[model samples]
Target: MSSIVEIKLSADQTEGTKATVAQWLKRKGEHVTINEPIIELETDKVMMEVIAPVSGVLEDIFVREGEPAEENIILGTILETAMSNPSNEQKNDREIRAEETPKNVSNDLPRKNPAAGQPDPPSTFISPAVRRLRQQHQFDLSQITGTGKNNRITTRDVNAYLSGSMDQSAAQNATYDAAAISPTAAGSEIIPHSQMRKIIADHMQHSVQTAPHVTSIFDLDLSAIIKHRKSNKQAFAQQGAKLTFTAYFMAAAIQAIKHQPKINSQFHEHGLEVFKHVNLGFGTALGDEGLIVPVIQQCQNLNLIQIAQELTRLTDKARNNQLTQKEVQGGTFTLSNHGVSGSLVATPIIINQPQSAILGLGKMEKRVVVEEHNGQDMMVIKPMCYVSLTIDHRALDAYQTNDFLSHFKAVIENWQ
Candidate 1:
């Protein structure tokens, strides 16, 4: 008698995610061991590997690469039938064929032609991020050497290739016309959505529908923090911490959250759910892949140096597509530093769902501002930036938004 073992996607992992089969590690006739990874599934939030549930031959594949796979769906099957009896299991044609000839009997695994005795060449494993990089750079995968596990190509290998040997002009001019695979109408191409892009669309739309959003903008003079950073950055560097403006921004945000605890809250049907911990999330861009936020949990207890160090590590991991699941969850508030990209000001940065508000920082520039010295008004050139707070009006109001920004501004401007 043959027993069938089915491969299924985890309900907990794929419940609300858009998952697609990234690739299959084993072919239909290959012998698979228990708990061996046989496939890779890609989603908007993470990349996951689905392992073999039983030690058996891969009997069937129900889902192919690039197909949408839902939670609890059977992806494939492993046949656990024994090769000892061939004539007795006449009802099963596939099972009878397994023992038709004498072969390697440990698992009696099926292969195309055992008589020829030529083993299949080992295949190179390309990770999702590495594949994306290759497509973006329009380079042949053969050009780069793999230095990863089992000779898999890592992101670092691709980066080294681009930096050391690849031509800048060639990379610049290399462009893939996604329109070739896209649907066209009247000379317009409808590009298909990637898993990440699809998730972003659904999430943003849900946030807009769920929250009544309101925004308030504040003008901030960053002179104090700038002077503080200039004097302390070298010392911070000695301690292996990079003192960027983001560290100061996060420090000030912590103070603001302390002042208005309601801002660090979530909207609920019964009432507002306020949180005691300040879990901070900052947006990091992943080229054209879209934005990912890596969070620092229990941030209220972290000092400025610790905050900067965590920021550095998380941002680096996020950009490299190496952030783990825990690193992206548990965000009580978010900070979108759009200023780093050269924007002067931005309005109503969308609130990350379940978080009451998000803060936006615009590009810092040297601007002339009026100041009072000895009770006399005078104009001075100072580094200035526009800070905006976007809140979910259902859980908060303009008063809280402005109050939070006011407290945040005070912290930044009056740094000791």
Candidate 2:
């Protein structure tokens, strides 16, 4: 008698909620040992490979590639059946016959099989973002070549291919006679949105429809902070860190929120609901598709080093399709660092639902300005950045919104 060992999903170290099965390494009837990598789970935080717990033959897979799975859910089963006993199993006759066939028997088989003796080579032909986009748009990718690392197709290539194909198809359709063209399009496609994308669209539409958004701008002088960062960035990198301006802004925003708690609040049916903890969500740009705001919880309590580490980890996970549902959830406030992309300023960023305001930081630039120092007016060069805070006017007045930005500016100017 053979016992079955189930392979279950596990959550990441952070407060992440769900993961998607990125890829599977082994097929049914393949023998695997304990701790062997069987599947890769793309959580909101990182891509984690779920290893086998006990040696057995992989029997059943409960999930497919690109499917969103909940945390702690069962992914597959490892049966205690021996590799030699291929005839006695639950698989259908076709599956059994296919399994019995030699690896080189497949019609699509190349002359030399690179995956014959070694473990399955990674399917690096398409990047994750591109694959997700293709799946979303129902675009067939038999003709596109990936330009990413290792010849992997990127999201941009897929998008461009889609656009070009659509234009060509539309032109070809117009040349056809009305009698030839069916009343209902024959080759049209109907693609469904992913769970993550649907949620994002719903929230974005709600925020735009419900909130009377207002944006207030302020300029900050970062001469002092720039010098401080220039001096400390080398030391920070020595500690295994990428010392971007985000860490500094996050620290400053925490101080500002502590001074004015009303900005870090939500609007409910009753009235304004203010939060005590400063849970800041960083609006990370994921390639060319869209943005995802992965939260950094308890910003007030964490030190600079800790903030940098978490930011690096979460952002990397977000880019690499590793974020969990929890990592993308529960944000009290949000920071949109549009400055990194060379934009000078942006106004009225759509609010993340349950949060009342979002802060936008524009590009940092050096400009000449006259200032009175010790009763003398002198032209001086200063690094300046524009900060725009978009608020829900239904819950907040303009005065309160402006005051919040003012406090934030003061924090940056007086950074230690």
Candidate 3:
């Protein structure tokens, strides 16, 4: 008799209420190594993989693809065995079934294997989240190609297809009827909101309702910082850190926070809870999915280079979906660099709950401005960017906000 080890969903998988089985990398009777990833769980925040606890052969899978799996539930079992081979009879049966299944099941549904003219397995091989998106868009799987490992269709691939198709249709029709393009039309889909999207919506709505929001905008001259970067960028690159304007902004923000601790505080019933150490959270956009704020804890202790390195690491992890629960939590202040996407400005960016203020950086551009040079007014070209600070009025006053921004502006302008 083989000893069986249960594979349970770990508590640290996510902070969301539930997670859906995104995919199963291993099948029943397949041999798996200890600590090897066997399954992926899609939570409201991110997609995480579950690893096998002990070396064994996968014996049973209780959670199928696209099914809701609660935390600590046994997802599957692994039998103590090293055998990798499947039974000859089972293989023959699988082959026969593959041959018998239709290549395309329905025009509205995705095809199993359009190129091979064979139907996909009965399971559809798509996560519930991706399947919901496909249905909502009324997409035919045969039309879109999968880019994931082993040609699995990912949510990103489906989003790209939708974007391209919409653009093409709009161009062809010029003034397309809005009703005709609605997903509720015939052959269209109405997808229920995913858990992650719902949570985000609720949080945002609660934030707007809870705080008395106020925004103050300022135009920043980046001449000194730009010149500094041009001079030392090569040196910074040699030290494995790419010198970017964000680092300068981060450093300036830290200095401002130090000067005004109230900017890094939260309002409570008892009193104001001001934090001594700045836990800076930077927003990273994940296309089609949503945004995530990964924090660099104790940011006040890090220098410019260290801040840059930490930001790079967190950003890379966020984009690659490798951030842990801890990395996304406990932020004292938030920054959204919306300028990266070419936006000019975004006012009154909602404060991340419990955090008093949020900063938004707009696009940087060169413009001609009149300046007093050598006791005379002179016109010169300079790089300028707009920075907006949105604060919870209850926790921060306009005077404090202005003071913080003044300090921040001075730091950048007088960068050594």
- Measured against the true structure, the TM-scores of the candidates, in listed sequence, are 0.74, 0.60, 0.65
**Global CA lDDT computed for model 1:** 0.76
Choose 2 or 3, whichever is better by lDDT: 3
- Model 2 over residues 1-416: C-alpha lDDT tens digits? 77998887655422343566766756676666677667755543334457787777888889988886666678889986555555433245335434433333343433446767544332233333444565566656656654333233444445556655777655333223234544446766444443345545655777788888888899989877788788888887878666778988888888788888888998999889999888899888865345678889877888777788788888887776556556776789999999998999998455476688989999999988799999999999999989999988887888878888888898788878
The lDDT values for all models are 0.76, 0.70, 0.76
Model 3 spans > 4 angstroms off: 1-41, 49-196, 373-376
Regions more than 4 Å wrong, model 1: 1-17, 52-64, 69-151, 154-193, 348-351
Q: Distance (Å) between predicted and true CA of 148, model 1?
A: 8.5
- By summed lDDT, the worst window of 10 consecutive residues in model 3 runs over 170-179
Q: Give the TM-score comparing model 2 with the true structure, all chains together.
A: 0.60
* CA error at residue 174 for candidate 2, angstroms: 24
**lDDT for position 341 in model 3:** 92
Report the lDDT tens digits of candidate 1 across residue range 153-192: 5554566567556476443233223444464577655545
Clashes per candidate, residues 3 or more apart or on different chains? 0, 11, 1
